[model samples]
Target: MRIVEGIGIAVLVLLAALAVLFLRRLVIARQGGTIELGVRLSTMVPGRGWSAGLARFAGDELRWYRIFSFWPGPRRVLTRRGLAVERRRTPDAAELLVLPPDWVIVRCINRQAPVEIAMAERALTGFLSWVEAAPPGESTPETRPYRYKTG
Candidate 1:
């Protein structure tokens, strides 16, 4: 009887935690210019470092928060001043299975660190537009038009 009660309580706690995560995702998505994004910090293993997250444009920074995280702050912040898009590509077979059908992969450099982002076509368009519209003289020459490539 005690084991049964323990299991029931554990299930309830799990449900409650899931509800909280869902609400957090909802609140983040309600913000302006927020989009579903997948960011991978490593490039050592191709098509292996993706993590689903929400990214929002705040001022001149694009802040990323993990989808399941409880923290209210961004996990990573990429500033417009030091971010550059190196190239864009279609996700390969392995990535396509894991990512959404319409999501594209983009390689970028932020503060001298490489970051890969996977997002839908519409979100990628918005991101490029935002980067292009940066404040005068804050843009880097590296922010040139993206060269398309296959994954």
Candidate 2:
């Protein structure tokens, strides 16, 4: 009977410890500004019924320029002129555009610059880091593919 009581107490302690750890993880993730893609939109409202379905499909098709580390963080929307002179111009001079969450339009400023490669690599790496740092029991997508539409 004593042994049973001790075992129960031990189990309760272990459960409490686990709960603390789980809460700690959530707090850290929130503080770190880590968020999963497709989970929330920082800008445009979600469409209704059929439109929402189409929007989802559109989202699936639109190529992700980058997976930003923080949601709704500072971003730059490059213009054609800006892109053309990206390599030549100082990084500080470059204007960053903070886009609406639902904005799928990606315009390249420079036809010859390495922006696409750089952006893609950064996004991929950021996503991998997010996955690695994610806490146990927190759900994440199994895979992400680069989807883009060409005009």
TM-score of each: 0.89, 0.26
Model 2: CA > 4 A from native? 35-151
> How good is model 1 by TM-score?
0.89
Please give, for residues 35-121, the per-residue lDDT of candidate 2 as tens digits.
222212222432211111001112112222223222232232223221221121111111122322322322222333323212222
Query: Which 10 successive residues of model 2 have the least lDDT summed?
Result: 48-57
lDDT (CA) per prediction? 0.83, 0.30
The deviation in Å at residue 51 for candidate 2 is: 42
lDDT accuracy of residue 58 in candidate 1: 92
Which regions of candidate 1 are displaced past 4 Å?
A: 140-151
- Count of backbone collisions within predicted model 1: 0
